[model samples]
Target: MAAWGQRLAGVRGVLLDISGVLFDGAEGSGVPIAGSVEAVARLKRSRLKVRFCTNESQKSLGDLVELLQQLGFDISEGEVTAPAPATCLILKERGLRPYLLISDGIRSEFDQIDTSNPNCVVIADAGESFSYQNMNKAFQVLMELENPVLISLGKGRYYKETSGLMLDVGAYVKALEYACGIEAEVVGKPSPEYFKSALQEMGLEAHQAQ
Candidate 1:
């Protein structure tokens, strides 16, 4: 798993995790944490691929690009994963459009999911992106579908930010599951599905992992 994290100083290769790995602390301070941004720039100079695999869940690549730029890290939309897009890709491929419950930015990506189908993928991310209305619809849809697929398996509560510790998306996800009486399907990595996809994206062969 990339969770072990590739060595930043030595490798002229993939750089996963944008905020903490590239910049210091968390959002706002935008200060480069001890050689983090430099490490990325160094890789870029050396032509190494820096793919930022984020469980960020919400926010579009454009938003990420702007934030990265604020911190003086030169990044593009291509090297990021906000999960919403990946979710849409999954549901679309499954031939199902999900009635999503997530942040505003994340909801944009749901356009790709086929809402007309009975199987609706209910989604949620951190922050105030989700609301009562969305959750209501999400539960209603789940009741109809009986087992709505969840996009994120992560239940992490709060991440450290420049300001301080804050709530993470997991809380809201749990709330929906409680109301809907269904569990979510995790689509991204660390989950075997996502982890394998990361490896495949990196063009690495998967051996037996303990």
Candidate 2:
């Protein structure tokens, strides 16, 4: 084995970030970053397992994957570990109905989840939907719950777009937490369990992935 191969001898899986990696913040499918499309294709052909992890909550998992494919990246929905799907799993497991304050594009990911008589609040990047009316509704749900639960898809402060940095779910989550005097359970990146879930999906332990 060569020097780089030796260094990666124990590595069984690789995690690639989606946004700002394979694609830029442009509108539509977004422009592919320089050489990223080929890089991803090469990685897919490599021996190491590959997984795309993202904190993106603006679109559904399927939509995101479709966009990547449209950009000429060899990616599929199954190979991507996204926040909305993970958050849905959390919601189902907890049997918690939510007052969802999320993007319209990503709502289909939570179609199976119950929102009737919400006992908790689930928030994400609602874009223009993050109005005072919507925020207040989410806050009201949390306040009514005897035990408040706030589930954030990703605790990202902001993300870059063609227009520049835009606010993410973390900021909104903080606002609700402050008003409700409760903490949120983050379901995406920077959370140990989130990374663990990706590792688990790849059938690789923490040390086995790069």
- Candidate 2 deviant stretches above 4 angstroms: 1-6
Candidate 2 lands at a TM-score of 0.95
29 in model 1: Cα distance from truth in Å?
8.4
Give the top-scoring candidate (lDDT): 2
TM-score of each: 0.77, 0.95
lDDT of 2 at 179: 98
Pick out the ten consecutive residues of candidate 1 with the lowest summed lDDT: 201-210
Query: Which residue pairs does candidate 2 place in steric collision?
Result: none
Candidate lDDT scores, in order, read 0.63, 0.89
lDDT of 2 by residue, 1-210 (tens): 599888798998899998988888665558888999998888889998999899988898888888888888888888989988888888888899999999899999888999999989989888888999999999999999899999988888888787788888889999999999999999888999999999999999998998
TM-score: which candidate is best? 2
- Residue 134 in candidate 2 has what lDDT? 98
- For model 2, give the RMSD to the true fold: 1.6
Each prediction's total of clashing residue pairs, residues at least 3 apart in sequence or on different chains, is 6, 0
lDDT of 1 by residue, 1-210 (tens): 464554333444463776556764444236677877777777778656556776665566576678778777877786665566666677667777666665666555565555775577556563665667766776677777755666663556766778878776677778777877777676655566665565556554444221
